[model samples]
Each structure stands twice: as structure tokens, then as C-alpha cells.
Target: MTGRSDEYPAAPKAARRNRGFEAASRLLRERIRTAGESRGFAVSRLLTHWPEVVGEEIARMSRPVKVGYGRNGFGATLTLLVEGAAAPIVDMSREQIRAKVNACYGYNAISRVVLTQTAATGFEDGQAVFLHSPKPKPAPSPEVQAAARATAEGCADDTLRQALERLAENVLARSAARAAQKKG
Candidate 1:
């Protein structure tokens, strides 16, 4: 038998090297890119960073649907899915939207912006979910907080008491607001 062992060939240096954990986004990037390409999106950044590309107000009312490239592939038309009621508002800001989208690509890639209005519930695919940021609730009045604390005073557990106090505060504050609204 020869001095060299041929039973098991040595593994490649790269394979032997320890590869630590990778980010989920890095692993799924290729899959995301492939899916985006199928929808005529050359770069997935436009879809992923829609909110950042356009302002929060515009993003809340609309979402990017797809990009359509012409036969020559010189200029592409970007289609935005907008809320039915916000169609006119979005249409008015078409130029601004187009400019922002073009700037995102670092070139005037988008020739025009098209808005497609959808019903209140949005499309069949359920892609358009109009999410509005919840307004911060005002702090409960001192009287309301005291009343809430008094209600939770009977609880022995510190954590449970604190939770009950918060619940009472919210309930009392909401009722107070309703009463004030009726008076106004």
C-alpha cells in the first residue's frame, strides 16, 4: 500500500472553515430577488423600501404594485396601488412620486407613475394593507390615576396590582373622554 491514504479524500479548505450563523435576510435575499424579478422589479429595494423612498403620508395611502418595462427597455412605468379615496390625492402627486422613485434608482429609470385604485378592503391578493399609526393616548388625569390606584389597592401581588391599576386607568380615562365628548 502507498504511504498516502486514498480511503477518504480531504475536504476542501472552505468546507473545513467554520461558517457562523448568517442573518435571515442575507439567506433569503436570493429568493426575494427571484420573486421580485418575476414581478418585473429589477431591484427589490423599491418594494422593500417603499416607505423610505416616498414619505410616510404617501406610503400610508399607497403601495408599489409592479414595474412594466417597454420593448426597448429604455424607460419603465411604475404602477402604484392606491386607496380608492386617495386616488385623486395620489394622482396630484404623481410628479413628486416619480421623482422620488427615480432618485431611489440613482437615475431617471421610471418614465411615468400610474395609480390603480382599490376598494376599501384592497385587492384579492391581500397585498395592500393600509396601516395607520395609532395616535398616542393622552396621560390619565391625576384624579383618574388616584382612583385606579385605590381600586387596585386590595391586590396583594405587586405585578398584578400594577396591571389592574393600568387597566382601571384606561377604562376610567376612556369613559371620561366619552362623557366630555357628549358634553362638548
Candidate 2:
């Protein structure tokens, strides 16, 4: 047999192109990682908006009923409860949604999404799903403060400082409620 050359075998043109694509993908991934870390975003926080993150995937399978915050903060994992035509379709849809969510988070935050069929309505209207941003933290008000303080001090269990703190929180909540009612 002829002696082999030290040089490697020549890669096909397609293989060379694939390598280039891989390199580009790697660079893009590194940039995203660096940016995410620098933005002070914890991995947990990023996982929150799994739905929005995987929007493209969700669109492919099931229509997004509600794309908003879940239990977490704003733009967190989207609560995507879908009602598709058939069970098999719905199952595949859920998987697609899951993939999209994972892709969106840039990690596997969502293991599986809860899926359900829409209740039959006479007109075939879509399911009633509510999507909303996280409720803003109500600010402390003067009255809440006073009440909290009274509750803390008079209660005997809490210290004076604790009472004041409680009062502050109570007052703030009351004020917020009032403002919300007025808006409504």
C-alpha cells in the first residue's frame, strides 16, 4: 500500500460551508451569552418569559391564547394554554411550544407546558385566555403606614420599628387600591 500523506483529506465543498456556518453560529452564541450576563439578568429571570422567547415555535403549533406573565415578574414565562383541532395536533403543538420556549430562553427552562382543549362554544370562538403584564408592586401609602405602626406597637409581639414598617406598607396599599378604584 502507498504511504499516506501527513496532510488531511480534503473536505467536500458542502462540508467547508457547513464549518463556516458553524463558526458563525458559535460567535453569535458567545455574543448572546456575554450580553445576557452583562445585563445583570439572572438565569432564573431569563427563564421567566418562556412563551415570548419561543414565540416562533408556538406560532407553528398552536395559536397563543395568552402571551403574558405567569407566576413570575413581567415578561416571564408566557402562559400559553392552547386549544387546537385534534388531540394529536394539540400534543404536537405543545411540543412545538415547548421547543420555542426553550429556544426563546436560550436554555431549557420549560420542561413541559400545560395543554387543554377549548370548551365548545356555539360560535367556535377561541378560548378565553387573559394575558397581562405583572401587576406593579403597590407603593406604600400614609394610611397603611399608620395602621401598620398601630398594629405592630399595640400588638405587643412586634417592636416599635417593626410596627412603623408595617403601618407604612398598609398605608401604601390602601392608597394604591383607592387609586385603582378611581381609575376603574
Error in Å for residue 9 of model 1: 7.9
Per-residue lDDT of candidate 2, residues 1-184 (tens digit): 3556755676666534544455664667666556545543334333344446555454444443333334664343334434455446656666666676556568665554655556333214654545677998665656666666665565554566675676567666776788899999
Q: Tell me the lDDT of candidate 1.
A: 0.90
Q: Which 10-residue span in candidate 1 carries the lowest summed lDDT? A: 119-128
Over 8-78, each residue of candidate 1 has an lDDT whose tens digit, in order, gives 68777764536678789999999999999998888799889999999999999999888999999899999
Error of 2 at 32 (Å): 23
> Which regions of candidate 1 fall more than 4 Å away from where they truly are?
1-19, 120-184
Q: CA lDDT, every prediction?
A: 0.90, 0.54
Report the number of the highest-lDDT candidate: 1
